[model samples]
Target: MRVQDTLKARQASIRKVVETAFKKENPPEASEIISSPHLEPLQIRDYFAGKRWWDITFQGLFDDYIGDSSACLTFMAPAGVEYYLPAYLLMAVEHYYDGGIITEDLAYRLKRSIMREDLYRMSLYSVEKKKAIVEVLVFLLKEYGDEEALEAMRAVAMHWGSDYIKAGGQELG
Candidate 1:
């Protein structure tokens, strides 16, 4: 398939996961985050409050908080991470080239999250969510060849290989 078609399919897959796994989820409250004083959790909360994850367009995130979408991923509660991750993944997919450091930051953060075993914990992500994440990681690995994506997938294969395989992910080196 064409790249455009692939992107559209990935978008549709992500949307389906968002709809199924994250339906009716609320954004993180200021108190739920552990941001530095400068980052200001309240501002982050205010930006996301009253909005579903799907409602948050990538272009409109964190204009005041350092102009980086990755900041939103940092210090977020697991629930908040669950809510906001799809937007990040979508941004990484759609804006991979023009997005500058944002895409790399997304990959790095995701790598860190997976390395910490936070994202792969069964308590945090359901099987369906894990499957969706694997698909996204596969796309990042195959399409972008991002080092962080490779590291993240390696972590998954090392620690959560069973789950990864069950999620329909191929083995990684």
Candidate 2:
């Protein structure tokens, strides 16, 4: 396949997996949306208010507050993270080759969230959700060769075992 075709395939896979995995998740209540300490909480809440993950367009975001929407991920509840994660994944795939800061920030935040040591955050995900995340991480690693994705994959392997990593068709030694 051509590189474009391969990228398209990866994008399709990411969209299908994420949408399938998170389709039934409810959007976090506006009040539940949290921002990083330096960011205004109300602005973050207002931006996400009444928006479903699927409904949020990447272009429509990241313009007002920061250069990218990754800020939206910081300090959120696990449920909020679950609700909004698909958007970030989709955005990252869409912008993978733009050489833009958006994809970089998205990838960075994604790795941090996955490797987070907070048991409260880690405990909320189901096995299926975790597997889906591994799948997405594998896609990012394979498609973009992102170092962040590789580190996140290792973290997932450490936390969930190498079997989950293997399921994504990648082996970590």
Q: Write the per-residue lDDT of candidate 2 for residues 63-161, one digit (tens) a residue.
A: 555433656677565666778877777777777666256566665676677667582276367777777787877777777788788888887777777
RMSD of each: 3.2, 2.7
**lDDT (tens digit, per residue) of candidate 1 on 24-56:** 566666555434455455566667666667766
* Candidate 2 deviant stretches above 4 angstroms: 35-39, 64-68
TM-score of 2: 0.84
TM-score of each: 0.76, 0.84
Model 2's alpha-carbon lDDT is 0.70
Candidate of highest lDDT: 2
Pick by TM-score: which candidate is best?
A: 2
By summed lDDT, the worst window of 10 consecutive residues in model 1 runs over 61-70
Off by over 4 Å in 1: 1-3, 33-39, 62-67, 117-123
Per-candidate clashes, comma-separated: 0, 0
